[model samples]
Target: MSDEIGLILCPEARYNRSPIVLVENKLGVESWCVKFLLPYVHNKLLLYRQRKQWLDREALVDITCTLLLLNSDFTTAWNVRKELLQCGALNPERDLYLGKLALTKFPKSPETWIHRRWVLQQVLRECSPPSLDRKEQADSDLRDSAEKTRLSERLHRVLHDEMKVCADAAGRYPSNYNAWSHRIWVLQNMAQGNLKVLHDELSSMREWVSMHVSDHSGFHYRQFLLKALVRELSQSLHHHHAPWPSPGTSSPCSPSPDPQPAHHQANREATAAAPCPSPATPEDQSSVPAMPQLFHQEMELCTDLIQSFPGHETLWCHRRHVFYLWHHWRRDHNHHDGQGCGSESPQLNHTDAGLSSHPHTASPRGVGLDRVESRNGQAQEGQNAMEVDGVGIPDPCDTKRLKRGPPDPCPPALPSEHGFVASVLDGCLSPEQGCFALAYRKWLDSVIGQ
Candidate 1:
């Protein structure tokens, strides 16, 4: 029995019989056995299977976690861990730590990412609602509000940590769809209602996009955040005015308060007539940057990035979404102000001013204007000399010049958002640009024409 135990434990005996050596080289055999084939793993697997059969939550959690650290793709093990989490035997934070460990080894594994999202969801569920109930004597509204605030703060911290982790994974693998999708899910679920939190998230994401311009996932997430921010701003505006009932008679059952003072009525009318530039209360003021300003800021950021990475299809796609949103906002603003969609609004003017003022200081087409001008001049002189030589054949250079026909004129600055987008897209429409660029340009034209 002692001799048999020695043979079983010997490296040569194990290497000869183990299928792990068939798949992995000698360099990994020792490490692999230490991590996955030690007596502890075999015992834990047996114990986990026993616990699973008996539905023992605590032991299952311990066993699943140990197995998961060694092999994150073990779907059954993750499912058992999920069961443990649901039954309250495993802490969500501990699950999160296990997820982090698993992800470090299996960043691209869909199972690991799905488990991470589940852990986050469980944490959120625990932090919210009936689980966070107040004592019986507590004032319901105040206690509920405080609990909600605390919940939001806790979720904000957790989601931000998750975002950092996702960003790190994405940096490691620029096209990691799982990482990007998980981050978007976190933002969509967790970052609503709080403008400061959204703004901070947007600021951080701007840095991330700048660093990872070629990654479409980051840009797509930015589009989601931008759209959400716009929606939040619109909702805030509605909320700010919801308390002030429109001027009209009240219900006969309840007497109305005294009519607004003339000065206050005038101020209200002024605010309603001109939607922009209304002063927010001190508490709400910080959250009230004009939507057009935000959109233009994003446009400039996109322009700078597109210039830096001209071939990046993701940046161009993101810009198209931004333009689409801006167009709708501009149209809505015009409708509210009793102006035709064709008429220039202040917001449109602001966008135009930004677009016109920031002339493409560098040639976008990778050819300098001066070089083109010089070539055209030389071509013209050659054509004149050929004409003097009485050669009737068109100079090839002249034919090329005619085909090119000097760069299109800088588009007339327009005050509509669609017009601005059209002009910017036109500038980007070099013959050498990608199919997406040309296709998007045509789509923009169709949208604008409609």
Candidate 2:
């Protein structure tokens, strides 16, 4: 690669080599450039660059496949990806190598779309090219066309099967951007008249997204579901005299239940004197916005999750989307607050220990610097005292010199509070007071509550 590209293919070309120079006491900007740019380079080159040349095609295929799976830049991977496709090794029956590569690269490059189109085009071009007239030549051409068609059909079948696997895997890991985008690309290029499969695919994806509403990736997937559903619904509603009821409305044609309260619970709790529908229980509720009305329901569920598990960073991050939407609504309304929402703010009050609020500990010093620093200093003092007694006084020459004089004074112990103040001033902790001091009353109540 270096011979072809005009640089050392191995060590000199290895990305992130600058620190190596600093550590090994070597010189040059070439090493520094290599170190700084390793993250952007393809893993194929990164791995082989550490070794001598004469690499195997399979080695490049495996390395490129892993890079595609992990999602290195599309353009960088693009250069090596052709090797995987040509190696005749990344079979759909064995693994979803090309499918995953296509999926991961879709967001950043036209190359993914190009690659898929190429798969189809090459298959067709090889199998069914135009004929030239000659009795022997025409017969040979016909046979060649037949072989190409057969091969193309086989590859297309692999393409479809691998895409299904990719979609299923994406459903399992909804947070994966590459997986989700790839699923979309697969659906887009599916055989034109397979509406039944397309509809079923959309339905399955919706169910998966609904099952994991707390996941931001799932929420994003729901937007994709809505887009697919709208198109389908629009086609179905074309003959209607009235405008279609907002999505998932009760209709004989639609499979979904009416946007009803969990009526099953209502029936379970039936009584002659109290006949209203029972409220949604946490278990019976769908966390996802199954219908348009359910979007607000999902938002409320996210808010409830925050209140229920305030210490969870994941839940807090999930709740931010609701905050963002509310903020947008407020902005549209001349800065008026949204209903049931407080002032639009992004503030999140997390403690230094990553807790949303200070947890009550029974110790005199709360979850703050006092105890941490005190313990640190006591251990340090013990070590220092041992050093002074063991080494300072034991040196015979120093002892003889000091024997005629008073013993040397030991160094003054450093104040623990000063260190605490310094750490706080450095923006690592609360500057106003120690953790215990900042909310003393709350800490006391928490202790009592526990």
Clashes within 3 Å, all models in order: 0, 5
Native-to-model Cα distance after best TM-score fit, residue 12 in candidate 2, in Å: 28
Model 1, span 1-450: residue lDDT tens: 000000113333333455233222211233435444545754766665676545356666777765665667878888877777777788887777677656665677789899888787677556645523456436576676576667656665677678777876777676788988887666555543456656666777888899888888778878877776776666555344322111111111111222444644553443232112112344653554556557767877886887666667788778778878766754454444343223333333332333343334323211123445676898677667767457665767556858986643221112233343445567665543445566665665466324
TM-score of each: 0.60, 0.32
Q: RMSD to the native, candidate 1?
A: 17.6
Please identify model 2 stretches exceeding 4 Å from their true place: 1-59, 62-78, 83-95, 98-164, 167-174, 191-193, 232-450
Q: Can you give the lDDT of residue 282 in candidate 2?
A: 33
Q: What stretches of model 1 exceed 4 Å from their correct place?
A: 1-31, 34-59, 131-153, 239-288, 339-437
Question: Candidate 1: deviation at residue 53, Å?
Answer: 7.9
Encode model 2's per-residue lDDT on 264-316: one tens digit a residue: 23422322121111222333222222222333434445445534433334443
